[model samples]
Target: MNPVVEQMNRRRSVRNFSGKPVDEVHLGRILLAAQQAPTSINGQQISLVVTRNKETIARIAEIAGGQPQVAGAEVFVTVVIDYHRTREALKSVGAEQVIAQSAEGLMVGATDAGIMLNALQTAAESFGYGTTAIGGIRNDPQAMIELLGLPAETFPLVGTTIGVADDASLAQVKPRVPLATFAHMERYDAEAVRRGVAEYDRQLRLWWDEQGLTQMPSYSESTAQYYSRVYFPKVAESLESQGFEFRDD
Candidate 1:
């Protein structure tokens, strides 16, 4: 396999860091990689805020559902989906309105943020750094917005913590669903998806058993329960309160 593919395959979330600091030059390169990530129609809708202040990191950790890694990592990068900058640009160019509050605009911004985050992660990994993405940043979107001093038309999408990982913190790579499960040729295949998920569940269960985690539920069941009971309700309310308009009409 190609070296890049091998490196990517080795990537896993690292929650326990060694607490050693990352060199500034390497951090600069990682940020540069994020800056070069592709965006929709050249609209750079993502902004990154690097927080190295210990006190601020601790506060962020509290806001992020008490993820200690946020405070203990060498650095925390908050990836924000920002239409505020674009809105200002439009105003400067004499455009009458900014349409960043709509669903389409939100999707574009979020996509840009995700792409940049991937770049950041890959770059950090290539530079011999361990990183983990923190989605808990959205657990309290309003608080995150106020804490980060984010302006209107900007939202925190995700966060990444960069540091050297402890030997014990390199978790085993978890199994992923087969490509056939999601990749289709021209049309969707419901049967393939069903079979694929069933196979994946079996594989996951085996892996969990080997790791002494037999209580873990199947991927499909867990995801369905989470979205239906926990994720959607909270996220929808948070997004709406942050000026995002979702229209399904």
Candidate 2:
């Protein structure tokens, strides 16, 4: 396998940061890599709000369930889905601007932001920095919006903490689903999921046993429970507050 590909394969989320500032040059290079990530139609509808302020990072950490990793990181980058820029561009050209109410707009904004985040993470890893994604930034979207001073049509979609890893940080890489079940060739295989679940459960059980832990719920069992109800009831309201509409038409 290629060296970079190999690094990606072995990469795992790390939550323990040493609170050391990333080198200025490395940080610039990492942002440059993220900027180079592909965007739909080259619209570049995403922007980053990066901070090295420990005080602000600490406050954000509290909002995100007090994750120490976030509070201690040297750099915290917020990936925002920014349609505000689009509106500005339209205004600049005296073109009529339209609000995004359909699913396609949401999909494009989210996918573009997510791809750029992957590039940022990969570049940071290449420079030996530990990285962990912070999805909990949306726990209270209104608070984040106010804290970051984000304007309408701009929302903090996700966050990433970057810094050196502590020696006592997480080291185990979680196992992924079997490739056959995860990826299909030519045509979809309906039975692959059934077989994959059984094999995955068995493997997970063995792993727990090796670690001297009791077996927990199987992957399907846990996922089914989690999806049984609407987990984030405020997400719709949050989106609306940020000028995103969900219209039935």
Candidate 3:
């Protein structure tokens, strides 16, 4: 395998850190790597707020359900999807057609944020640093926005934490679903994909068993029921309360 591909495969999210402060020069490089990530139509709507202050970090971690990973991070970076830029651009150019100022526009910002985050993760791993992405930052949107002092038309898309590795605990790679399960050729192949997923589930279960993780759960069964019970309603209510309007595409 190519070295870069190997590096990527070996990358894992680190929840524990050594609490070593990253110097401004290295932090600048990581930020620059993120800035260079690809964006939709060259319209980059991702905004990042870097927090090194103990108070802000504490507040963000509190809003993230008191995840120790967030508070323990040497640096906490909140990545937001910004819609105001698109609105300003549309008005500036006098475009008659405007994208809906809701989830549709928000998707663009989130996509940009995701791409940039992946780049930062890759760069950090290459530099021998440990990093973790915190999607839980979206759990309480209003609190996060208020704590970060975010402006209107902006939503917390995700967050990232960085610090020095303690002892390479996160050096191993997590298994992924088989390509046949998600990757398609010229057209969709549902049956083939289903079979691939079954194989993947078996592999995952075996891996879990070997790792002595608690009783292995069916991948599809848990995933299908997870949203209805845990994520969707909370996320929906939070977004609605924060004045985010979503329109059908």
Q: What would the TM-score be for candidate 2 when compared with the true structure? A: 0.92
Quantify all predictions' global Cα lDDT against the true fold: 0.84, 0.85, 0.76
TM-score of each: 0.92, 0.92, 0.86
Compose the digit string of candidate 1's lDDT tens values, residues 45-155. 789999988888898899888988787888999999887777777889898434565678877877888888899999999999999999888888888888889887778
Cα distance off (Å), candidate 1, residue 156? 0.5
Collision count of model 1 = 0
| Each model's total of backbone clashes | 0, 0, 0
Query: What is the lDDT for 72 in model 3?
Result: 82
Off by over 4 Å in 2: 211-217
Candidate 3: what lDDT? Answer: 0.76
Overall local distance difference test of candidate 2? 0.85
lDDT of 2 by residue, 79-176 (tens): 99888998898899998555456577788888998998898899999999989989888877788889889998888889998999886855666677
